[model samples]
Structure formats: C-alpha cells, structure tokens
Target: MHETDVAIIGAGPVGLFAVFECGMLKMRCTVIDALDAIGGQCTALYPEKPIYDIPAHPAIAGGDLIAALDRQIAPFAPRLLLGQRVERMTDLGDGWIVIATSAGETVRAKAVIIAAGAGAFGPNRPPLPGIEAFEATSGVRYFVNKREDFRGKSVVIAGGGDSAVDWALSLKDIAAKVMFVHRRPKFRAAPETVAQLEAAAERGEVEMVVPYQLHGLAGDDGVLRAVEVATLKGEIRTLPADHLLAFFGLSMELGPIAEWGLGLTHNHVTVTPATCETNIPGVFAIGDIATYPGKLKLILQGFSEAAMAAHAIHPRVFPGEALHFEYSTSKGVKTA
Candidate 1:
C-alpha cells in the first residue's frame, strides 16, 4: 500500500499538468496510467499529428506538445505508476481507498483523480459481416500502434473522424495504396487537415471513397484479400485490400468508478465549473472525464481545470497557506 495526497489516474496532458500543479501547492502526488508510457492518448493515438490550437505555437505535433509539457513539470519529480488501471474505489472513513490493478498486482492510494480520457473508451469497430473473421485471422487492425507494419500494403481506412483522416495522411507516403472510406461526404477533421488530405487524393497518393460503409471483408487462407463497400448511390463495389483499418470512433466506459454514487450526466462525472470538484468531497474529476456547464473538452480546458483542482486541494492538504504562486521560466540571452 502506498499513500499520497493526490493520485491522478491518467498520465495524459491533463493528468501530467495536474501532477505539476499539485506539486506547486506543496502536496505529494502520484500518477498512475494504464499505458506503459506517459502522455496518455496524445502519445498513444496520434503523436505524429499536428495540433494547431494550443495557443502559443502556430503548429505543434501532438507528441512534441506532450514532451514539452513533460519537460515543463520535470522539476516536480512526481511519482509515476505506469501500466496500472484503477479496479475499484472505496470510500473509507477518513479518505478514499483506490485499488489499481496492473500485471496481477494491486496498489492502493488515498485520493484518486479520474483523468482517463478517450482511453477509457474502447475502439469502435464497424458492424460489417466477416469483419470479425478477418480480425480473428490477424488481417484486420483496429488501432494502429506501428505504422511500419502497413508499409507497401493496400490499406482501407473507415471513418470520417480526425483519427481516420490523420492516419490516412500519415500513411500516404508509406503505404503503396491508401484508401479512405467515410460514410459522410464531409470530414470532421480540422479544415487544414482536410485540405491536405484532399490534395493527397488529387495527387493520386490516396483515394477517397465518400458516402460509403464497409459491407463485408473477404479473405483467403485466413488473410484478408478485399473489402465490399456500399456507396450512397445504391452501388456496391469490391476493392482489393491487404489490410482493413477501422477508426470509426470510440465508445467510452466510465469504469467501476461510475457506480460510486457520484453525480453524473450522460455517463460523465459532473464537477464544479470553477474548482473541478465533484459532488463527493475530496474527489475531483479532470480532463475529458469531467463535464460542467459551459465546459469544452479540450486539453487547454483540462489544464485550467487541473489548476483549479490544485487550488481547491491546497486547503485540505496544507493547513492555512496562501495559494498564490507563479511558474518561473529560465531566462536566456536573446540575440536578434
């Protein structure tokens, strides 16, 4: 059993920032994440994708932004528990008891913050017949962890979301034949990303299959060979494909913590808009896991929520200290 003033549940951008904010308030902190490394979904899902709305830089890769955030908070030296998932949480007399499961080991912590972003939500698979058979045969991939495996292979991606488009663009150069199949005519990705993808399509680097849904997967000898698609104009076509990648989206699971009598709306924990405090005392939710009035689900918004949560925890963790603090950056001589 380990004890800490705060135990953040996810090591994503929000959770990492929370660790630093808690440290600034002179509170001991420990962060646990289900992934082996930090940076959560940003690192796990779309690290190579560019993020343009982070306020400071005009454009930064998701992986680079995560690394910069990690560097900014390195001085805190927060304890990190990777590859762990919170199995259960029980409210004890004084504080809450969190049981995290990782590789057959159960670790306990005092206070817990559920920062599991879309990670808690498993991948959404297209409901196409024979798709399961192909997946079982290792011919279908749901989440792409390594891009090199698909090199020189004819790949078909399904989905109109950011993940699907970003991956289509990322693999355009590596994949011999890349095709993006979306049920909708318009994409949901950033306009700039959409423009880039359109250019790739125009240059014959990628093919766009609009207003189409995967109908079935065909394979021979337990390996995928092609896919059957139904287009919007009542036309069905079969395309040769070596691999099928489904990035339709994800469905979130609140996990066991949802049954802890916490107030929730639409399966998301409700928190105070300003403080990020939940209905339960000593329990706070941050990042995409939390919802409040006028709350927008963005990494920048999560950072602000974490700072507010830290301010609220200061009184409970540290007796009567003033909560005013500032982050100091090292000065460098500039020659312009």
Candidate 2:
C-alpha cells in the first residue's frame, strides 16, 4: 500500500501541473496513468502536432510541451505509476480514501483528482474493407509516431482534419510521394495550415485528391499497392500508394468513471468552476474530463483548474493548517 496527500488519476499535462500546484502547498502526490508513458494524448496521439494556443510560446509541438511539463514538476518528486488505471476508490472514513489500480497497487490519499482526459482512447479506424489487414501488415497507420518510417515511400493521407493536413505537410519533404485525399474541397484544418497545404498542392510537391472519399484498398498479401477513392459524384479512380495514412480522430471512452456515480453532463464529469471539485467530496475533476458553465477545454484553462483544486484540497490534506498562497517567483520552488 502507498500513501500520499493526493492521488491523481492521470499523468497528462494537466495532472503533471497539478503536482506542481499541490507541491507548492507542501503536499505530496502520486499520479497514475493508463498509458505506458506520461503526457497522455499529447504524447500518445499527436506528439509531432503543433499547438498554437499555449501561452508564451508562439507554437510548440505536442511532445515538447509534455517534456516541458515534466521538467516543471521535477521539483515535486511526485510518484508516477504509468500503464495503470485506478479501478476503484473506497472511502476509508475519517478523511482517508483508498484507490486501487488495475495493476494491483493500492494507494491511500487524503484527496483524489480525476484528471483522466477523455478516459481511455483509441484511433477511429476508417471504414475501408481490409483496413484491419493493412493495419496488421503496417501498410496503414492512423497516427505518425515517426516520420522517418515513410521516407522515400509513396504515402496517401485521408482526412480533412488538422492531423491529416499537418502530417501531409510534415512528411512532404521526406516521403518520395505524398498525396492528400479529402471528401470536401475546403479542409477543416487551421487557415494557415490549409493555405500551406493548398500551396503545396499547387506546387506539385503534394498531390491533392479533393472531393473524394476512400472507397477501397488494393493490395497483395496485406501490402498496399494502390488506394481506390470515389468522388462524391460517384466517379472512382485509383491512386498509387505504398502506405495509407488515415487521420480519422479518436474515440473516447469514460470507462469506470461513468459508473462511479459522479454527476455527468454529456460524458464529462460535472464540476464547480470555482474549485474544480466534482459532486463527490474529495474527488475533483479537471482538464477535458471536467465540465462546467462557460468551460473551455484548453490546457491553460486546465492549469488554472489544477491550482484551484489543489487549494481546495489543501485544507483537507493538512487539517488545521491554513494555506498561505504565494507566487512561484515570490517563493521559488524548493526541490524535495
């Protein structure tokens, strides 16, 4: 059994920042994540993807942001258990809570924070036949973990979302041939990205198969040789491709949290904006997993929520102690 002042049920960026906030109040934290590594979706889903809205930085890659967060919380020395999910939470009474993980680890904490953003997630696979076969043979990939894998190979990307456009641009110079096929004429990606993609299409560096949808796959023994696509008007054609990159987004599952009796609105746990505390006492929710009035699912917003939850939980962790909040610049972090 492990013991801590707070048990955080996610090791994503928001959860990592929570450790910093709680540590500022001199509280210990143990963070648990279902992924084998920390950073959650940022690391798992789109590490190479660029984020523009994070404060200070004009633009930062997803993986870099996670690394920065990791360094920021290093002073806290918080315990991190990766590839584990908190399966059950029991009230031990007298302000103590027991959190049991799927990995057979038990943690006792004074408070709990449910920062599991979108819970467990998996790629939204496209509906093309034999897609799973291609997946098994490495001919089709949903997310790009490494751009070098497609070097000097013909690659066809399907989708109009940011992931599709971003990967197309990222892999254009590396891949021998890069083609982007989308169902609509106008891409759903950011304006600048769309402009870049359009310019690339015009320059002949990347082929644009617009107003077309993935219709079929042509391959031998699961090795894709070409991709069959159909226009919305029913015209069909085949595009030569060694690999198919489909960025159809992700399917989120709330998993056990939905059965935990917490008040939920459209799958997001309902929380008070003031403290990010959920309907359940001592169980707070933050980040994208939390829902409240006028809520914005931004990382900066989640950082603020983490601070709020930590302050709200301070009194419970140190019963009679009053928290004297101070800025990091005023009272610099002291490494434990």
Candidate 3:
C-alpha cells in the first residue's frame, strides 16, 4: 500500500494545482485519476479548444493549460496512479484513511481530496439512423480534437448551446463552408458570442439553418456526403457537407463518488464553503465535483478551494504544527 499525507481522487487541473498547494505546506500527496492520463476532460475531450477566461494567458488550449499545470506541480513529485478508478474509501479510525482502487492498488492517507470535476463529460449523441456507421469513419464527430481536420471541408454544425455556436464561429474561417443548424431560432450561447456568430452570418461567412433539427446522415461506405435537417413542421432540408459536427451538451456522471456516501446535491458533493470539506471529516471535495453556497463553478474558484482544503487539512497531517500562512511571493516554492 502506498502511504501519503493526502490522497487526491482526481488529476484534473484543480487537482494538479492542489498538489502544488499541498506541497507548499509540506504535505505529500498521491494522485489518482480514472482517465489514463491526467488533465481530466480538458486533456481528453477538447485539447484543441481554446479557453478564453484563464488568467495570465489571455487564451490557451485545454491541453496547454493542463501541460502548464503539470509542470507547476512537478516539483511536488506527487505519486500518480492513472487509469484507475477509486472504488472505496475506508476510515482506519485512527486518523488515517484507506483508499481502494479498481486496479487493486491501496493508498493510506491522512486526508482525502475529491477533485473530480463534475464527474465525466460524455457527449449526448444524436439519435440519427446510420449515425453509428458514419461515426466510425470520422464522418460524424461529437467532439473536436483537432480543428485543422475540418479545414477545407463543408461542415454542418448542429446544436444551440455554446459548444455548437462556438465551434461554428471557430471553424467558419477554416472549413470550406460552415452551416449552423439549430432547432430553435434563438441560440443558447453567450450574448457576445451569439452576436459575433450573427455578424459572421450577416457577412455570408456562415450559413445559418435555424428552427431545424438533425434528421439523418447522408453517407455511404463510411464516407459522408451531407446532413439532413428538418423543421418542427416536417420541412426537410439537406445541407451538403463533408462532415457533420454535433455539439449537443454533455451528460455528467459522478461515477463512484455517488456510491461513496457523501452528501450530494444533484450529483455534486456538498462541502463547507470555508474549508471545502464534505460531510465526513478528513475528506474534502473541491473543483466542480464540490458544491457550496454562492459557489461559482469556475476553475479560478476551484483553485481557491484547493488552497482552503489544503490549509484545513494541514493540521490533520501534521498535528500540533501551526501553519504560518505566507504568500507565494514571500516564501517562494522550494522543491522537495
């Protein structure tokens, strides 16, 4: 069994940052993730997707952000067990917790941090006949891994949410012809982004197919030719396309955390706002998996929660030691 001061049950951005925070406080951590690699959904889902809200860098891809976080926590030398889903947590009752994983590895820790973000983000696949066939050939894609792949191709973007609208705008200049098809006339994207998309449409840069839903996929022998969309009144229109990009929102699953018996609020772990601790002592939840009063579901907020959880857990890891709170600037990080 691996032993550490803290066992972090997610290796996403927030969890990686938590390693840095805990390391700063002299806490050793063993990080575990269900994914084969770190960075969570950011690394897996949309590595090429540009994130605009992250501080310092005005714009960074999801993959780049994870790379930077990984580097930031490198000095901590935290133990990482990838591709292993934590199955259960056992309270040793003597200030130590035992964590069991599906991989048969066991971890004993002074405290636990659940940093799994909003469970897992699985795309909601559109129910189109022969969709599975096209999907196998990359003719229909639910997630954008590489933007360049869609270049010079007639693309049909379907959905009303941010992912659909955002990708349409992002690929408008790259794709040979961009078609935006949504069931509703009004989009569910941010106002500013919607305005930009509309402005692009006005300039004839994008073809907007409104009040329509994905009807079927037109393809043969693993090759796609067009996307069929229809209105609520059964008006069918076929948009000639090389590839169909469906951006229906993702479905979230808490996975094993739901079975861990933590106080859950709509699949999110209920935690104390002050310390980011769950109903059980010595087990803290942070990032998107955690919920509290007035909590803003943002990466920056999750970073702050990581710090709070680390500080609250410091005492348990090192009993009788008073934590001298000091800013990073005052006492720069020292590699262990």
Top candidate, metric TM-score = 3
- The list of candidate 2 runs beyond 4 A from truth reads none
Best to worst by TM-score, what's the order? 3, 2, 1
List the pairs of residues colliding in candidate 2.
none
| lDDT-superior candidate, 1 or 3 | 3
> How would you encode candidate 3's per-residue C-alpha lDDT over 1-336 as one tens digit per residue?
979999999999899999999999989999999899999978888888877668898778889999999888888899999999899898889999999999999999999999999886788999988888898999999888899999899999988877788888889989999999988879887788899999999999999998899998887797999899999999999888999989887899988778877999998999999999999899999998899889887888999999999999999999999888898999897643
Kindly list the per-residue Cα lDDT of model 1 for residues 1-336, writing each as its tens digit. 777788888899999989877876667778878888998777876676666678888777778888987886777777888887767666675655555565444445455667778437666777776667788866787666677888899999988877788889889899999989988879888788899999999999999987788988888766999988997677998879999888877787877667778898888888888788888777789999899889887888998888888888777666577766665344321222
The CA-based lDDT of model 1 is what? Answer: 0.79
lDDT (Cα, tens digit) per residue for candidate 2, span 104-145: 999999999999997888989888887888999889998877
Measured with C-alpha atoms, the lDDT of residue 155 in candidate 3 is 95
TM-score of each: 0.86, 0.94, 0.96
Assess candidate 2 and give its lDDT.
0.90
Better of 1 and 2 by TM-score: 2
Tell me the RMSD of model 1 versus the true structure.
Answer: 3.9
